[model samples]
Target: MGRKVTVRDKILETAATLFYNQGYVQTGINQIVAEADIAIGSLYKHFKSKNDLLYSYLEQEDIRFFTTVEEKLAQKKTPREKLMAYIDFRIDQQKTGNCTGCHFIKINAEIGRTDDEVQQLVQKHKEKQKNLIKKLVTEIQPSKNNFDAKQLTEMIFTMIEGGVVAATINGNTRSLEDIKKLADKLI
Candidate 1:
């Protein structure tokens, strides 16, 4: 029998978990290959380089993370509920041990805005999320007051990033709860 065709995706999945949990700088291709139980050539076959694998991993995280969220958020009837659902989902995710500060932001810092495909993917993911926050804010409040909407959205996203980092580093889930309260106030 020949090797399974799922090797590439399996490798990418392992790479994403490792790269995000441990900084990209701290993860090496050899480690990914070991964790993935795939040959070195298998990784190289799918991605041209470690950067390419990291780029693909970030994109996958974006798709999986937001798709899961938008799916859950859709179940809520009101935008207000949906917005709160987003915060609640983050807290719930922390409880499940999936917490790692925003993967894009963490990778972006580790990579330091390098002119590489991975960094570009990271920027795109962040911009997409920021835009989503803006959209959700507009939907929830339908504000004629542009300043309030803008400030609230910015503060909420900021608090979210802070909460994620705190949860991952200190295991302090109170930050997530505190941020949700602050988000309610800002909104």
Candidate 2:
């Protein structure tokens, strides 16, 4: 039998959908309460404020993103293969339109700098991603190394993020494909 969803789950699900699809500032607490089918007091019980909810949503995304990445990377044996797998996973996500671009970026663009907590969460999420990529870069063989690991990490990270932004704006994955090629050349 399936487990029942908690009031917290309902609130988070509703808020995540609304925040990602609609801008964070545009999605009101009332809408989340109504869509979640929960009482106003219930939301407050789980989250102190809308900002608190946004932080929870971002934290959730961070965990989900890395879990998926770990699963994808595990399928590959070598570090190079693992890095390529990550890029390919990103490309597939964009191609399938399974996501509406990166939620972290979308939320950050909406209100990251204004909210110190959100800003820190975004920074932490990005740093975690960069560090993971850097680890993969450092593990690759010397023959494949075209640039220093640090430089390569920055390039690959920038390419992945820039490609996502371009693909999101153009409604196509061409930029992502190009990014994959460029990354393939560098590493």
The residue-by-residue lDDT of candidate 1 on 33-148, one tens digit each, is: 99999899998999999878877888788898899889988999987788888889888878776565677778878887565776778778777766778788888785444466
Superposed by TM-score, candidate 2 places the C-alpha of residue 96 at a distance from the truth, in angstroms, of 3.9
Q: Give the Cα-based TM-score of candidate 1 against the true structure.
A: 0.86
lDDT of 2 by residue, 127-180 (tens): 998998899988984356557889999999999999988888888888989888
Candidate 2: residue 102 Cα off by (Å): 0.7
Local distance difference test values of all predictions, in order? 0.81, 0.88
- The C-alpha stretches of model 2 lying farther than 4 A from their native spots are 142-146
Which pairs of residues clash in candidate 2, taking residues 3 or more apart in a chain or in different chains? none
